[model samples]
Target chain A: MTLKANEIKVGDTYSEEVCRNLSRTQIVQYAGASGDYNPVHTDQLYTSEIAGYPSVFAHGMLSMGMTGKMLTNYVGHGRLTSFGVRFTSQVFPGATLTATATVTGLREEGGENFVDLDVSTTDEDGTEVVKGTASARIDA
Target chain B: MAVDRFPIEAGHVMMFARSIGDADEIYYNEDYARSTEIGNIPAPPTFVQAGAQFDPDYFLRPRIGQEWFGSAKGPTGITQRSGSGGGSGGGGGGGGLHAEQHYVYHKQLKVGDVLSATTKPGKSWEKQGRRGGKLMFSESVTEYRDQAGELVVTATSVGVRTERPATSS
Candidate 1:
């Protein structure tokens, strides 16, 4: 589906309230599915005792997904072409994470419309958790 | 259950590609693959999972008592999945769902070149409830390197755990 100008415009922003905090059971489930089980995430003892983190943290990609959902929910379907992000900070369960995106670029070609968004996610204190850019093929 | 950072060879990619039945010329045909800008057979978008040790289903299904409602497909950016639920490589079903996945494109894996990937959860968190369900997010980072000590790829991914209200059917 193509996004109308009202759907997402440059400088447009949307904020979804943090609904659920992360947990070990979730990580273990992902590990079993994604084939990723590095102890740094699943083993609190390893993260605190061996890896040096106060507690097991969430995956950067996992956080990115939250950000991605924010963007996709706003833009709708069949309008996204490329999306990516970079991890800058660690996220622990129970923190209220706010995913935000700013529209930076937009254009339309013979047949396809292009919408570019600069995305940055932060925690309760405004810590940049993950920051990156995303490009979508919109209809507007 | 981190993706095994196994040394991937051309032969291995072929087998892996076959397992997914990608059947894309770029994944199997050398004569056709070399003709593209990628220069060689390329792995599918989901090929990153080649380094994994378990099926994608393990995370998609209800874990005994944990029944979560999710869309088959996630945000348009990138996606990754299932498998305590058993199936013979059935297509990773479609729904607007997003789970754990990380990608690090440090270098490209050319045809016949072997590479390995290692991954782990970087962090995790849970939210009370949104859209009538609780949400849990997990982040995992993946590192892909070759036997030659060269970094091939790096990715950090996230997952959303949203379980419907106990009263909802």
Candidate 2:
């Protein structure tokens, strides 16, 4: 169901626990699905010894993908007009993430109602991992 | 990356949605999607990134019969280093890292829509890092058009090449 423009005001927020204790297997699953099998995300020995990271980490896109779920669940199916994000920090295995979308503005254009959102996803330590904005169609 | 034929299939959509931890019925169940406002299984917002699967030359994926960079018997398979690992994370050898991604949806991307993508370089800039040395960032925009040649999605991606590996702080 689409969000009703009259029901939401600027500053309204929705949040979801996107993932908990992120696992290497889930990171590999994302790599397989997204076709970005970078060894830094899946190979432990390669990541530590070669890449010089403590361990395998999640793709920035994987964090963005999980955050998008919170947007679709808030806005409705097939309603997003635009979505963008910047990767702020690396997300490693065992980190829990929470995504939140805050309503920034609401307007009507060409007879279609729309809602603009400020999106942010943070790890268990409250460090922002992905940050950006999204706009979606809404019901008046 | 350019893809001549990127079919938005149901199984692929389901796998992508599941991988992202989304349980939305519209992403998987055909009958449920048929009743929704979208009227069909629609690709998740970030789904088009999967077009790399159709890109034959995507560097992140290990090509058959080629020496891969990841470890096999030792710390790495390749004997010679091409460049330094850079980017935010998930660096493929010395390739750039993904910094930002943006998408504008022209229409709902649904199952059965075969998309062709064409990418164009956007912009490039440099920045100084506190610990990772110099950061070189570049942008690329890809337009995904359906079989009928209608633009379905416009994706803009930014990649950063750090002078050295970015250590997690």
Candidate 3:
């Protein structure tokens, strides 16, 4: 039930169109589930006044989650072996977030099929919130 | 969460790794981790959150006793290979939409390295979402300090939440 390496070639793109919008309750829940509760995430006044933000924002991990969705949707679950990323900018709430993955490398090593992906989450203004790479070992 | 009272210890690093489903050798085996560039087991960026350490009352007083849910909380690998929790479509965001996410690693986390983390709400607001749904993003900034109280890592996560659409399921 997993995607094989040969099944995913370079230049493959998955449909990552956002389906539904995220809400406040979900943010609170994520904080609870993830055990993160920085004021910058939940307080608009602090962000706009103290932190110098236009408003509150989404968690960088959430942006990464979107990238994970893109990779999993394309390569399937078990097939994805490693995923990592670096955060570049803040993602404000209500900003349209889009996830995309570009296969940078597809090779065989130690008798394994692997795909190297350059993933990213961008705002409607093309602000890259999270940039990352994901590699998957396709089923033989 | 009794985070500050947990009494951070070197032994707890391994225990934290086990709790988060990360079996990365570097996190569990000090010797193996020492062989890497980090010279020790590097804490997964998001795994740092597991420390549950908070700032002293005199340091960040306004942030004491904040309420936290266990829903959208995700780990951002802080200073090394980082990330955790998987699933597609934010079918479970508590109230905010996931606008963006990113992590910056200043160095590597090693075995026996004791660290502390404190959480605080960033900001909140209302915005119009596509199709008229209410949208918001909640940012949480956690500061990680080493045993010497030196700032080791600073992690900020944003939770973008919007009202679920009223369209057909």
Q: What are the DockQ scores of the candidates, in order?
A: 0.05, 0.65, 0.06
lDDT of 1 by residue, B1-169 (tens): 3443455456555654443223446556788777765677654433455455433343433334543322123211112224342211111121112444434345555655555556677788887753565767677676766678688667666655445311110
Q: What would the per-residue lDDT of candidate 2 be over residues A1-140, giving only the tens digit for each residue?
A: 88999999999999999999999999989999999988888999988887878878899999999999999999987899999999999999999999999999999999999999999999999999999999999999
Q: What TM-scores do the predictions have?
A: 0.48, 0.96, 0.48
Clashing pairs in 2: none
Tell me, by lDDT, which candidate is best: 2
Looking at candidate 2 chain A, the ten consecutive residues that score lowest on lDDT are A47-56
Interface RMSD of each: 15.8, 2.8, 12.7
Q: Judge the docking of candidate 1 as incorrect, acceptable, medium or high.
A: incorrect
**Candidates sorted by DockQ, best first:** 2, 3, 1
- Write model 3 residue lDDT over A1-140, tens digit each, in one string: 34666667778765464313555555544444344555456655444443334555666565565555566557643355456666666655566667788878888889887787888777777777677777766666
How would the candidate models be sorted by lDDT, starting from the highest?
A: 2, 1, 3
Leading candidate by TM-score: 2
**Predicted structure with the largest DockQ when compared to the true one:** 2
Cα displacement (angstroms), candidate 3, residue B77, comes to 29
lDDT of 2 at B15: 95
* Model 1 lDDT tens row, A1-140: 23676566667776664325666665555444334444444556434443344666665545665565566556643245556765666677675677777889888777778777777888877888778776666665
lDDT of every predicted structure (CA atoms) = 0.54, 0.91, 0.53
